[model samples]
Target: MLEHRPVVIDRTGADIHDEARRIRAHGPVAPVELPGGVRAWSITGHAAARLALSDHRFSKDPRRHWTAYVDGRIGDDFPLIGWVLMDNLTTTHGADHTRLRRLTAKAFTPRRVAAMRPGIERLVAELLDELAAVPPGRPVDLKAAFAHPLPSRVICDLFGIPPEARARMLRGGETNVDTTLTPEESAANVEQWHREMYEFVESRRRTPGDDLTTDLIAAKEDGSQLSDSELVGTLHLLLATGTEPVMNLITNAVAALLTHPEQLALVRSGEVDLREAVEETLRVQAPVAHLPFRFTTEEVVLGGVTIPRGEPVLINFAGIGRDPALHGADADRFDVARKDKEHLSFGHGIYRCIGAPLAWLETEIALTALFDRFPRLTLAVDEGELEPQATFIMNGRLTLPVLTEPAVVGSPSDVTV
Candidate 1:
């Protein structure tokens, strides 16, 4: 086991999975420091994280509950402040949390997500066609060409952003999730994001359309009592959560498959189910590495370590996903056929991700289309050369360059030829 140390989360040019394993080696709860030298706790065990996330003693409302935040130690210009300081469902608790979540949930039901299948399938098909058009010998950054745009496009369509305005909205959303940006750049990006979303909400009010945004607005009109800031915050949350996870999910899944040919063969041969593959990818390489800055109401003993009151608690979902104590010594290995693949990739309890169903559908469709179109897809660069996203929050490749061999004519590429 590695000697427990104060782990810092500046993810630039670092291999996140390896770093996560090192943290896990330190024990379930480890000393960690954030970007601004802010001290915190990192929950690195699966069971421990599940408990901490659901524990009522911990609050997500950084603005009201976080002492560092209240004392100005953490400011809006802080690189990670945008995540913790939001006024959305993620940052609220008790009745307010229930009310906001209920209002948003009403519009984003399982039925509504299911209804998006045909459109999602169509969009995936179009993207696969574009990938096919790329020349065979040359490499294409699949992350840029496909993974990033697909989810944004889906969310924009569902949000009823007119076709014309989708581009600007997507650009803003991209900047908001990017951790590579300097603190100053992130602040500017946040401001730009707020301006765009605020305008979008007002526009939706003026001209409603057959979209989820309209549905949410109508729900508000029907006595939901959603304030303007809350409404915009909800919309921003939807856009950010909707894209970041799905984008990373797709990118990580592809990276996993291309690096593990035997597992990819099982997927291609239908021996291993696609759902199983996606779930395994989620378990092995969680889309979100660590959830930033959940504050404790009081001093809490976690994994035999005492965390002081109002200190930030970062749930290291990535570390937990690979914790051998929970998943056995082979937890780090990617095995699509592995059973008992329980994981906290989508989080646990009330604060769990609301867009999980949509994310699953999008990833499944994207993978299915890409593989069906070109079964011989392989990485253009060495797996080691694939750079991870600079931010510790998201564990995904910056660019996934791949070479897609043409599909076989006589039989499916996995079969003959």
Candidate 2:
């Protein structure tokens, strides 16, 4: 047999899809190198990714199963250490996973998410009003002005994070997922994040509020439901997941629609709804592109390759989202009306994203209200000029500049869904 070489993934996230294409060419299960010269297997095909995500042999508890991590080869300076070492629902296995997920799900129930729709709609309207006030000729960075803040505000309110500390929380969340950080930067970020999270939890304990943080605090104090460390870790996970992913989803959908005018016309003519557009966007550009560090419990054969026991694996969501075998030859093309709009962007099986319902509601409302307010909105710069976010773990533009033109002449109430 020829010698196996690991494909080194780009840490800067310059062109993740291009990297994904190369990895897929290697096979469904491909050896890959992470930022710290760390070796892992990537699940590059749709079927393979789904199987790996739901397979019992794949353990999310890296502390127990990941040889490098357990043996001290992976350290604090590793760029992805923060993500791989978390104690939240994302990294737990078996009964621990079940318990954490159950507690987290209570805050994201369909009824709770649906109840927030009116508040979300109101927030969207307020944001649109602010965007409308910008001079017609000046280009606006939609990612900054609209996309990022909408989800930030929604999640902060949901968790009852004090307004004074929201900015630090947002910064810490961004730093946690950025793969391009230097060893010093990564270590500092992890330390800062833990400190801030602990402080926030303590504040919640001192003065309970009507929010998810308070509920989680209560569970932590219930003497068996949640440990103190788990409480902080869970909050950290919720803050990170609840903000950045939804921000990217809105920006990606808007970018997709702006680039594909025909698809935009379909939505404008009522031929396709905004929800369909959102789904298509998710299929093409998943928010979390490459989730980190699931290890194998035993030798497992997949796609004609065997991952040895204790070997690490990554779910390549970016590659799987556009897998040609499942999505057909034109998988890359953005089509709002495409049939069989199936995707594992939120994930699969027990690890499915608990905040998915809230994400969907936020995106749908934000998109509808945005298009309604600025019917003639178009990209201020060429699509090629857009810059990808600095992290391989998350997929989004660093900035999306657009011109909001021919503004609708109406009050907030005049804008109808």
Candidate 3:
């Protein structure tokens, strides 16, 4: 173990980028303390992060590989217990992981995601129409009214969640990523989320629908392909992962474009596509900032530091995205026209996010339609005054207040796509 004291991470989302810079100063593989006093190593360099993510020595299953959790140092009351303990595809290994991923991939096929484009465009149109109705001078929260609902509604519709049940599920997702919650509150939130997922699964099992949930249930009934626990856990994972990160992607992209008027002009003047803006936002303001709990299967040397077996590791997506070595000195700046816009915001290796295609399609459509409709949209407050989301795991604004300039709603012919 390293002799120096571990750097305690900020539970509050504020200063995460600053914190990442501080962690990088400690070295690529730096000792860090998670919320609730859980000790871990954070991978801060782009190459080191890629190695850790793809290396076979690093295992995602905490129940088997995490010494602290196995020996009871991390209890059920730990605020982040739910993240590591879940039995979804994210926490499986080898054959189990392959099997789970194979089963889950059916729902996210290229055809299925492509088919969602028309519906997604319609949803974007409806949202833009609603934003156009807001009084010109009054500030409207685009994050809540636009970003949050688009993905939430898409996921709910994809899973066949009833309109009445969606609000509760969305609230549960908010709780899942909130690292600032108390032990008691976190435990209770986990319990409630599990209960809600169980009910959802049971409801779908009883009344089959033309949705992914129904498809998954059918697989579960065929030759023991999935267990009850796995079924509920998969749904829970899908609902949470499907909504929150995509929500942040849209909001963060809009925030980036609004603050960086030069970048916005690039998109508006046809110098660059909206996709470039989305890619730049993903690089600078990664939606999932710091992912949790990849444990060492054996002693491994990373960045000249020795990590013992069973030690937990965190992949700092935020830090790696802005690494000067990879993205040059201006990595921190948001530039849509940058030649190299590569990022691990959707992750890497076999564990790379499966919903990435859907997320990209949703965000591109959302941004294009948004700019096309409200050509004069501007931030209601100074960029510095916008509040960050309360959790370190999710990089986004709590609210993006914007003046939607209803009078300037542009026609389709004016779109810069």
Model 2 RMSD, rounded to 1 decimal: 4.1
Which is the better candidate, 1 or 3, if ranked by lDDT?
3
For 167-258, candidate 1 gives per-residue lDDT tens digits of: 77766656655666778887777678778888988888998888888887777534666788887788888887888889999999999999
Please provide TM-scores, in order, for all candidate models, with all chains considered together: 0.92, 0.95, 0.95
Residue-by-residue lDDT tens digits, candidate 3, 327-377: 988989999999999888888888789999999989989988888888899
lDDT of each: 0.82, 0.87, 0.86
Worst 10 residues of 1 by lDDT: 408-417
Model 3 residue 100 lDDT score: 83
Tell me the deviation in Å of residue 374 in model 1.
0.8
lDDT of 2 by residue, 1-417 (tens): 242689898998999999998898888789999988988998878898888888888988888888878999888877788877578886888777778888878889899899999999999999999988876656789999999999999999999998999999878889978888897887788788889988988988899999999988776322457777888889888988999999999999999999999999999999998788888899999988988878998999997688889988999888888899899888878899998778899999887899999999999889988998898899888999999999888999999988887433552222111
State each model's C-alpha RMSD to the native: 4.1, 4.1, 4.2
Clashing pairs in 2: none
Candidate 2 lDDT at 161 equals 91
